[model samples]
Target chain A: MRYAGPAGMDLEKMAVPLENICSQCDYKGTPDCREPECLMGFARRVLSYAVQKGLLDVPGASSLIPKGDFKHYYPEALVPALAETCRQCKECRDNHTPDCVVALVRSSVEYTVLSDSIPYPGSVFMYLARIKEQNPELAALLAGELSKKG
Target chain B: MGDGIFRQKNGMVAIDIVASCGVMTPEQLSGLARLSEECGVFRIKLSTRQTLVAVLDEKGAGRLVESLPGLGLKVSPYGNVVRAVKACAGSSALCPRAVGEALALGIEIQDKYLGMEVPKDFKIAVAGCLRGCTDPYCADLGIVSSGREVFDVSIGGFGGSSKPLHGEVVARRIKREDVFLLIDHVLNRFRALGEPGEKLGRAITRLGLTPFLPPAGVKEAQQAPPDDFVKFLED
Candidate 1:
């Protein structure tokens, strides 16, 4: 599917290695600075790369996530590649996490941050507008997780 | 990374390959493809300036550039050096409107001035005819060949998207043999008179085109067609 967000933002470049994604996602930081760095370490890596390249061209690329985490969110920061990877996962059939840990964990984590009722922290509305376009299944799973938790 | 080389955001170094008048043989293509695989590049991009660009991790760039066969690959890493010359190798039967070989002329220009520094990054293009598929008029200097042995020369073309401007013809119906002489004359004049950082187009605008015209008796001008670009589109 054709995904569009900030102009010139490459999804694969912004994505952390799949194996490295959730190391400490529970710590905090949706699209901004997360404490102790997550397993993926994408936010820090992307920012460092951008600063090194002098590449603050994206619309909201250079903006800093407010200090001290409190429902900090920017759904648009999620890598769209994760959705495509979920489609290829052989374990997701009939909707299960055996082969799709990323899908399950990403949604659950996003859902948790989406509300106190769920299990995570933080709140971001940009993902609501962008997730389905980037990856429908991930968005659906996150919604499903929210519905079940609520 | 040096003068002409720039580091990509992904930490890969982008190496620029100057194509001879945008022409490369299948052997060269296959060779480059093999090199790309060995060097672990993501993809090969065809740049508009008639050059091939490949991004490789910092460790692989030096090795890849070192292996390009002499003459088969000319890497012009950024800076004030002459960029590649773009051209349309006129299809004989398919495009009879073309009288001269734009590609051949482009190669000759490449040999003569591809590395010659003049003022700023001066661009040159050669088109088969008025169709100008290669955007001859948008270059710092350009040639549009019409008859089998004649071309019209234009200067001061700017290709920037923000301020695109078509060059004006300074001479019309120039002989094939004299093309190089005229180009040499233009460059010599530009260097002696142009500001260090000024682009050819901007310099022409500031200094005017009359002073830069081929000196008397060098190449005769036949009324030197008017700024036909603006008129052609508006018409």
Candidate 2:
């Protein structure tokens, strides 16, 4: 089924390596069973390839898997696995579950940071400094306070 | 209607009246509406199901309740008492899946819990089948028909400002004899551990079903009870 509004963007066109896509495809009936390291092996290789090609920014990426006593990250495993299969496929946009998760998280983060009025790190502080520079009385007070400060 | 003599913090002690279920008639309603006007109760709020709720000042509330029996109504709300129940017009009226009588069972449960206090508000909804036209899953306790004279009893369902979760069936194919006993078990269990302001669904979720189970080797306690409404029509 086609999702009309904001979900019209095609995600599968992003592309995954051919070898990785072949192994990840569940052609056999035992998709839910433990296939030793076959599934995880394919996932790790695909993620490495994406990072090496600079297609995915690893330093900025959030930790997809949780730490501690839990054995498996049941839902998070879907991220790389889905990204691999959807690579270069126009039909990726048709899949509701995976695409919706990424879209919602991105939208939420943007809404939280950009929509706030208070100053933040980097560019915002620079803008505040320029405003203070325009006000000579405030600037003199800051200069005197800095000279007298402990 | 006479002037009131006492007042309470919540409002005024306008009236106190009691009557059996099914005892009120149309003639009584007409008389009460007039008495309510005389007592100064200007409006009556019809509940979600089929119950009349009147809000009046102290004098009017007292007079309405006093004259209620003559008009065939009652004034009862609050406490752990089983309040009015909601049910859909079943097969007898206009539903296809009404194998069991929904309205009759609803009335039976209402009478059984009438005037009895529990730990919190207990709601009972009876639907002819799983279509849930009357919103069975929205009640704290619910009964949905599976077949003729057969029903699945569900517990811990509720609906309001927050979304409601559908209940799980603890028993199935319940016969009429065990209906009241099942209700008694649930009510007594709730009364034992339920804290003030906690609704029946919240209490059940907190305590779980282990406490409500029958003790080992008790034959009658082994199975869940049937709903009385279906039994009434079967008989």
Candidate 3:
């Protein structure tokens, strides 16, 4: 599964350590077979597994949280669904897994909740336009100067 | 950090240093331009080799060179660091005839030699193939691909201000493992007796290619047929 995000989405949090699964594979003790490429592939496979179970959120969604605080802004309903998925996945086992998808989702969700409390993008632009509108006298003087140059 | 900053005191000598070819990123160039302008520089020139040379009266030169790398662009004008290994934008991004990644290898050479002081400034170039979009004769060392996984490494080539013609084949159909070592040997020999301020081609002319020939057991020096040279990179 491909996880995509805009900001505040950390790829490191979704990654699992390859050493945990090394003992389970036949190539564990072989010097020739223990290549860096092979280890990197195993790590990628674990990420894919987490994505397949719908346990990870896309990267950009985490930025939706307000002020970097999750409790203040994330939707309440999404929290329980994320927790349930985390509890059911065996990939989240402490010893076998380096990272779990649930923890990542919870952190993202909390971030989103906090972000929701900030001013919307359009509102800031609107405020700037209002200030320009309020200064009509200064605007008229600037216009007069332009007309004189013309 | 020196007091002697190269700048145009009278502002009449409008010198424009251009960077034509190199591995510099766009942001790095933009920052360089801004910094140069701030230092009362006349103009920043971009060379055909993708290198950025800022033209200042001798005063601003020090500060510009010192600051550019912080923005990710390092000045490697005349000292070691594989002096501007030129490579065409090949099949990795563009170009239909490219059989292998010329830019990738060029980048590898650049990273490996970025700041290493050599006997003289050594230049290596990579072209997608014989089309020579990069003008193979212009580099001190040139690598042009023949086919899948094969490359032709040319030596004693150069271009731009005071152009010098490239010389005969030192090696042909070189594999990846041999390329780096071969280049290292070439550079090491050049550095051993290269006179200060002497260009690589000039140094080779003074020393002669016979002394730099590959060691015994390696293929003897012979003029490779154009077609055999074409497959040099593929083997």
Q: What would the TM-scores of all predictions be? A: 0.55, 0.48, 0.46
Give the CAPRI class of candidate 3. incorrect
Stretches of candidate 3 off by over 4 Å are A1-150, B1-21, B24-26, B33-41, B56-63, B79-82, B118-120, B159-163, B193-208, B215-235
A27-76: candidate 2 lDDT, tens digit per residue:
42465422222333223332343333322211111222111211232222
Q: Candidate 2 on B117-166: residue-level lDDT in tens? A: 77676777788755676787777777776544556677777787475667
Which scores higher on TM-score, 1 or 3?
Answer: 1
Clashes per model (N, Cα, C within 3 A): 10, 7, 46
Q: Could you tell which candidate, 1 or 2, scores higher by TM-score? A: 1
Residue B153 CA error for candidate 1 (Å)? 0.1
lDDT of 3 at A149: 24
Q: Global lDDT for candidate 1?
A: 0.58
Q: DockQ score of candidate 2?
A: 0.01
The DockQ values of the predictions, listed in order, are 0.01, 0.01, 0.01
CAPRI accuracy category, model 1:
incorrect
Listing every candidate in turn, what is its Cα RMSD in Å to the true structure after a full C-alpha superposition?
22.3, 20.1, 22.8
| Candidate 1 C-alpha lDDT tens digits along B21-45 | 7677888888888888888877678
Measured as a fraction from 0 to 1, the native contacts recovered by model 2 come to 0.00
